[model samples]
Target: MTILICNSIIILITKTDPALQTPMYFFLRNFSFLEICYVTVTIPRMLVDLCTQKGNISFLSCAAQMCFVLMLGGVEFFLLTVMAYDCYVAIGNPLNYTIVMNQQVCVQMVAASWISVIPVVIGQTYQIFSLPFCGSNRINHFFCDIPPVLKLVCGEAFVNKIAVYIAVVFFVIIPFLLIIVSYGKIISNILKLTSARGRAKAFSTCSSHLTVVILFYGTASITYLEPKPNQYEGMGKLLSLFYTILIPTLNPIIYTLRNKDIIVALRKLLAKLLA
Candidate 1:
């Protein structure tokens, strides 16, 4: 709840403040919005399951939850990739940064990230459910996730597992590769700077985002990319809790606390409210 409120406040601050009207903050606004949707998708259902102690989700509801969670997860990955490009441009081509990442381009990147995942998620949801679920209906995890649900299937889900592998490759691995490439260039550019202060400043600007990327991708990879779905069922749930529950709460802090612009904007907003 606290994280959701903070993310909402950040979104409002980014959208309303003229000083934050740059490509970086614009991306931050969308990322904050994504965090809200991301947590809402799973946390409410988790709470309900905890209270009821049954953890039973209807077939349709489970499918819907899976689709929304996958869609939002996809969007976050793509948005982070776009953010990496934005950061690379800001550092590697400072003079052309504004021109390169103009408002229209930023809007289009965000829109594309949100829109492009619809078909993919639709296919994934359909594929996962199309398989046989003839065994116990109780989902192992607090929320309905693909691996735990797959474990409940009466028959072999070899093809479904393969499909998940493909999807993970395209969605998770590809974006990570792009981020690496972007950061490689960013580092190269940073190293070229002679002034120690300039290099430190550049690295400082990117460190928060890099930290966020590491946290998000690390847990997400373990959740989705384990060699066998059933191998780490217990560990998987813990990892899922970290990413789905904990990470959203940490994101607002990660992005804002190191951000001077956000600090200044927040102080101004506080002053305005106090006045």
Candidate 2:
């Protein structure tokens, strides 16, 4: 609940403040919205199960949860990639940044991020659920993530596992690579600046975003990409909790606390309300 509210406040601050109308904050607003949806997908259910001591979830409900999780997670990576590009344009080509990242371009990029994930999520969900599940319908992890759920599948899930790896490459690794390339260019451009202040300012603009990218991709990679041994089942759940819950909780703090613009906007909004 706190994470949802904080992220909502980020969305509200960005949307309501005219100073936050740039392509970067535009993407930040969308990212905050994604954060809200991301936590909502898993945390509420986890809380319910904790309170009731009943971890039972219907197959259809589990499927729906997994679908939403995959979609939101995929879109988040795409949005981060877009944000990195936005930073690249702002720092690498300041003169044409406004013209290149105009309103239409930003909207199109966000739309692409949201729309591109649909097929992957749908296909992955269908492929996983369509498999046979005989005896011991227990999912080792908290939610219906790809690996644990795949473990429950009766027979050989090699093909399904392969499909999952392919999807991870597309949804996670590819976007992360794009972000890396964008940041590479951005760093090169920043180094070219003659003034130390200019370099500091440029890096400051991207530091929050870079922090978020690291936190998200780092935890996600560890959780999804690493080999999960039977002895490490508890460790797997802890990693899942980190990405699904902790990352969302930390995002608002990273963006708001680290960002001057967000702090100023928040103060201005608070002043107006108090007045």
Candidate 3:
């Protein structure tokens, strides 16, 4: 509920305010909307389960949920990478930032993030659910994540294991590497600045995003970047809960607290409402 409210406010303010339409805030608006969808993909069902203690879902429903969640997660990973690149451009090439991150390119980046995941997610979800679920239908985790669901399937999951590794590479590691590279370039540019105040200003633009990247990638690394195939053995559910619930809840707080532009936008939004 808090995630819903906070992220909604972010989307609303970002959209309604003319001043918040830069490439960074454009990405942020999309991310806020994505968070709403992302958390909604699981939280309401989680609430229902908590209240009634009934978590069983039909095969079709389970497949649908897993497909949608994976698609959205893939889009988010792509969006985060795009955002990291946006930061890199803004900092490393401030003179050409406006031209390079023009409105058309921004829209293309966002559309590409959403569009590029459809085939990948569909193929991966098909492979995952294609396995026979002859074993216990009970998912060990609260949500319909791929890893826990795979555990319920019968037979040796060689194909599914490969799919999992591919997903880790495509959705997690690749984006993470891009973010690292973007920030590496950003740091190099920041170091080149002669003035301490100029350096601080450049660093400030990235600090909040860097914090979010660390928190997001850190939890995701624990969840998906396991060194071993069976690494999600004992603590998968706990880690998923942390990322799906706790992280979304914290994201709004993180941005609003650390970002002056968002704070200003929020204040202006509130004052307009109160007026």
- Write candidate 1's Cα lDDT for 1-275 as tens digits: 88888998899889888999999999999999999999999998888878987777789999999999999999999999999999999999999999999999999999999888889999999988887778577777878788988888877888988889898988899999999999999999999999999999999889989998999999999899888776878999999999898888898998789999898889888889999
Q: In lDDT terms, which candidate is top?
A: 1
Per-model lDDT? 0.90, 0.90, 0.86
Arranged by lDDT, best first: 1, 2, 3
What number of clashing residue pairs does each candidate have, in the order they appear?
0, 0, 0
**Candidate structures ordered by TM-score, highest first:** 1, 2, 3
- Residue pairs in collision within model 3: none
Off by over 4 Å in 1: none
Of 1 and 2, which scores higher on lDDT? 1
**lDDT score, candidate 2, position 133:** 91
